[model samples]
Target: MSHNINGKAAGKFAAVEQEFAKNFAERGEVGASVCVSVGGETVVDLWGGTADPATETPWERDTVSIVFSCTKAATALCAHILVDCGLLKLHAPVSEYWPEFAKNGKELTTVQMMLNHESAIPAQREPIRPGGFLDWDYMIQRMEDEEAFWEPGTRNGYHMVNFGWTVGELVRRVSGKSLGTFFRDEVASLLSAEFWIGIPDDFSQPIAPIIPFVPDPKMELSPFTKKLLTEPQSIQALSFLNNGGWTPNDPEAHKAEIGGAGGIANARGQVAMYEPLANGGSINGVTLVSAARLAEMGKVSTATQIDATLLAPTRFASGFMKSMDNRAYPGGDQMSAVLGEAAFGHVGAGGSIGFADPDHDLAFSYTMNKMGAGLLLNDRGQSLIDATYAALRA
Candidate 1:
C-alpha cells in the first residue's frame, strides 16, 4: 500500500524518493517515512509502506510512530529553550532547580551531566508499573533516592530510560509545567509539528505499535555488560525494556509520559519539530530559542571513547551523537563525508533517527515501526541517510 507524497517542494528530493521505494521493496520495512528540510524549506516529505504488521492499512501521511530515544533530542530542545530564557542554566548544578536531585552525591551534577549521560542516574530502586510513568513525583523521588552506578561526571553511559525524568523534572520545577506540556505549547504548536513527549489523546488511533526484534542467541553482551547491569542504576536502565518499559503488550502504555524515551511522531512531524534548530532556533517566523543557545548545543561536551557501561567506543555531544572521522553514524563512513562536526540529534533503540545538521541547514528525520536486528543505526535508516547525502551532492 503506497501513500501519496503531499506538500510543496517535493520534486527536489528525487534521490530520497528513489531510496524510499528501494527500502520498501528490498529492506522489509513495514511502515516508515523520511523527511528533509533545508534552509527552512521542506525538500523531501515522503511516506509509504504498510502501517500494521498484518498489512491491513496503508501508512498514511499523518500516521505517527514511536521514535523511542529520538524523543531525547526534542527533550533536549525543551531544556535549551529554558536555558535561553534564563529560566535554567546549562552549567549550574541541577540541584538548584530540583533540590531532591542533590541526593546520592549528585549535588554537584549539572544540566550538562544529565544531557551528556554522565549523571550516573539511570533508574530507580523501585520498579515502576508500565502505566505508572505518568506520575512525575513518584518517578523523580525514585531517582532521588537511588544511588549512582558510577561517580557523576567520571564517565559516559547511556542514561537509557531515566534521562527524560531527570531533565523533565528540572523543566517542570523551573517552568511550573511538565516537559510534555512545555514542548506542546512552546515547540510543537509553534512549528505546527505533531511530535509529542507524552502522546495526546486524539492521535492515539494513528500510532503504529512498536515491534521488538527477536534476540539473537549468538550475540551476547560481554562480561563487562553483565557487571554493568548488576549495579542498581544499571538495572533501572535495563528495566525500560522489561514488562515495564515501552513494550507494546500494554495498550495504555503508549499514553505514559516518559520524556526521554516515549516520544511519538511521523517523519515529517519529527523533521518539522527540529527545523528551527537547523535554522538557528527559528523556522519561518517562529523562534524557539536564540542562535547563541543553538550554538551551545552543537559544541562537544563528550567525545569518542569507550563508553563506561556499554563498553564500546561511541562519539557523543551534549545529548547528540557525533560523527567521527574513522567511523560515522551506523553507515555514514562510506557515504558523503560532508557531515559537519556540529551535527546534533538522537537515535532510537531499533533503527529510528532524527537530527539537525546546521552545516547543511538541514533537519532530517526517519522513523519505522519494524524493529531491526542491530544495536547501532539499522540498515534501512543508514541507506536512506546515505542516499539523501548522495542526492544533495548531485
Candidate 2:
C-alpha cells in the first residue's frame, strides 16, 4: 500500500518515499513513521503500517507511540532552556536546586551527572510497584532515602527508571512545577509538538503499548555482568522487571509521569521539537535555548567510559548519544561513517530513534508501535535513514 509523504520537501525526497513504501510491504513493521528536516525545513514525512496488533487501522501521520529513552532528549531540553534563561546551571551540584538530593553523599552530583547517566541511580534497592510511579513525592522520597549503588562520577550506568525521578526532582524544585508541566510549557508548547513527558488524559487514546522483545531465557552474560547482577541492587531491578515493572499496559502507565522513558510522540512532533537543537536551538524565531548553552549540551562528557551500564559501546554527550567513530544510527556503516561525529541524538526502546545530524543540517525522528528484536537501530529504520541521505545526495 502507498503512503503519503507530506510537505514541499517530500517532492525532493522521492528515494525516501520509495524506500518507505518498500519497507512497509517487505518488513514486519506493524506501524511507524519517519520524518526528516534539513536547515529547519522538513523534507521527508512518511508514515504507514498498522496502529494496533490486529493490523486493521493504518498508522496515520498523527498516530503517537512511546519513544522510550528518546524522551530523555526532550527532558534534557527542558533543563537546557532553564540553564539558558540563567535560572539554573549545568555544572552546579544538583543539591543546589534540590536539597534532598544531597543525601547519601550525592551532594557532589551535578546536573550534568543526571543528563549523562553518571549519577549511579538506576533504581531503588527496594523495587517500586507497577503503578506506584505515579505519585511523584513517593518516588522522589524513595530516591532521596536510598543509597547510591556506586560512587557518583566514578562510573556511568543507564539510569533506566531512576533518571526520571532524579531529573524530574530538579525540575520540580527549581521551576516549582513538575517535569511534565515544565516540559509542556517550555518545550512542547513552544514547538507545537505533541510529545509528552507525562501524557495527559485527553491524548491517552492514541498511546501505543510497548511490546517487549522476545526474552532469551538462556541469554549469556559476561562475568562482569554476572557479578553486577549478583549485587542486591541488581537483584531488585531484575525482580521489578520479572514482576512486570516495565510491562504495564494501561494508559495510566503512560500518564504516570516518568520523564526518562515514558514520553509519547509521533514522527512529526518529534522532528519539530528536536529540529531547533539541530539548528542551534532556535526554529522559526522560537529560541528555546541559547546557542552557547546548546553547544554545551552537545559537548562530549568523557567523565565515564563508553562500556558502562548499558552494555553497549555508546558514547554519550550531556543527554544525547554521540555518533563517535561508529555508525550507531541508520544509513549503514558507510553513510554513518561519512556523517561524522557532529550527529547526536537518542534511541528509544524497541525500534524508535531520533537524531540530529548537524553536518547535513538534518533532524530525523522515527517512532514505531511494533517492537523489534535488536536493542539498537533496526533494519527497517536503517533503510529509511539510508534512503533519506541518498535522496539528499541525489
Candidate 3:
C-alpha cells in the first residue's frame, strides 16, 4: 500500500517523491523519512508510515531514530573542528593530546590515523564489563589497554564501536567537553539541527523503535556477517558484536554518548547538519571549518582493497565515507555507497544515511527504523539518493 506522504517536495524533486512512495509500495519501508537540500535550499522533505507497529502510532513531523554510525560523521566533525581551531593537530601523535593513549603500542598513532580507521585497534580481544559503554571512564581505560590488531600503520580496519571512544577521547581531552556536548555547542546548535549524540533520560521525543535484522537462509550473506555468525573469535565478529551490553533499542543507549554508533536523528535533522558542509562549511554565517579543512574532510584518506572488519572494499575520507563503488566485486553490490567523487559522509548500519555532495551543492539524508539487509546503504536509501541526483540532472 502506498502510504500518504506528509511533507512536500519541490517541482523538480517530484522524482524523489515518487521513489519515496515506491519505498512503501514496491519496497518494504515500514517507517522512514528522507530530506534533501541543494544550493542551500531544502528541495524535498517527506515522511510517513507507522512509528510503532504494535501501537500503529504514525510517524510524525519530528520523530527521530538511532542513526547508528551516521553519528560517526558528527563525531568526526567535532574532531575536525578542533583541528580547524588549532586546538588539535591533524597529523600530531594522538599522544600529544591524550598521553595515556600511547599505551599498548599506540605511541605513533595520529589523530588522522584514528579518523581514517588506521589505528590498528579494531576491537578489544577481551570482554568488557556489562553496560561498560555507558561508563566513559571505563571505555577510555579500555582504549588504553586494547592491543593493536596489526602493527600500527601497516594496515587499516574499521574501528566499529571503539571509534567513538578512541576519537571522542581526543575531543574530550582537548575541548573540555564530552563528544555530544562539543557537537551540540559547535555544530548542531549552530545549525539548528535536531541531531544528538546523547539524549536526556527525560527526552520526551518519540523515537521510532528499530526493527532488528532477521537472517534468511536462502539469501547470500556477507563475509563479515557469515564470520560474525560462524567464527566467534574473528575480528569481524568482535568488531560488531563486542558491544558491552549496549543494544540499539535499549533505553540507556539513547541517553549515552556513544558517538561511533549511537546517534538520534531524522532526515530533516541530518540535512540541516550537513548543509553547512555542503556549502563550504558555513550556512547562515556559522562557519564550522575553513575551506582547507572542508577539502580535507572530503578527500579520500584511505581506500582499502579489503577492509579487515567488513571484508569488503571500502573508501574513507578522514572520518566520513567517500563514494564506495563495490559493485564489480563479488557480493559487493549491496555493500556499495554510490555518490559523487566529492561527496563525504557516513551510513548507519541500517538503511539510514546522511551526506554532503559539494560538487552538486547538495545535502541529503534518509532515516528509517525498519532496517533492510546489508551493512551499507540498502535499496530504500540508495533509491532516494539516486532520485535526488536524477532531479539534479533534470
* Highest-scoring model, TM-score: 3
TM accuracy, model 2: 0.87
Candidate 3: residue 195 Cα off by (Å)? 0.3
Error of 3 at 359 (Å): 0.6
Q: What's the CA error at residue 133 for candidate 3, in Å?
A: 1.3
Question: How do the predictions measure up, each by TM-score?
Answer: 0.88, 0.87, 0.98
Write the residue-wise lDDT of candidate 3 on 1-394 in tens digits.
3365799999989999999999998888888999999979999999998888888888888999999999999999999999999999988999999888887788899998999899988887888789998888999999998888887766778989889999999999999999999999999889999899999677888999999877578878778888999998899888877778788889888999998999999999999999989999888898999988998899999989989888898999999999888888666766888988899999998779999999999999999999888888888899999989988998
Give candidate 3 misplaced runs (Cα > 4 Å): none
lDDT of 1 by residue, 271-324 (tens): 988798889888889998889888888888885355664445666777776654
In candidate 2 the C-alpha lDDT for residue 129 amounts to 61
| Per-model RMSD to reference | 3.6, 4.0, 1.1
Report the C-alpha lDDT of model 2 over 3-66, residue by residue, as the tens digit.
4333333776877777667666776666778888999988877777767665466676677888
Q: Please count the clashing residue pairs in each candidate, in the order shown.
A: 0, 1, 0
What overall lDDT, based on C-alpha atoms, would model 1 receive against the true structure?
Answer: 0.74
Candidate-wise lDDT, in order: 0.74, 0.71, 0.90
TM-score for predicted model 1 compared with the true structure: 0.88
Best of the two (1, 3) by lDDT = 3
lDDT over C-alpha atoms for residue 173 of model 3: 96
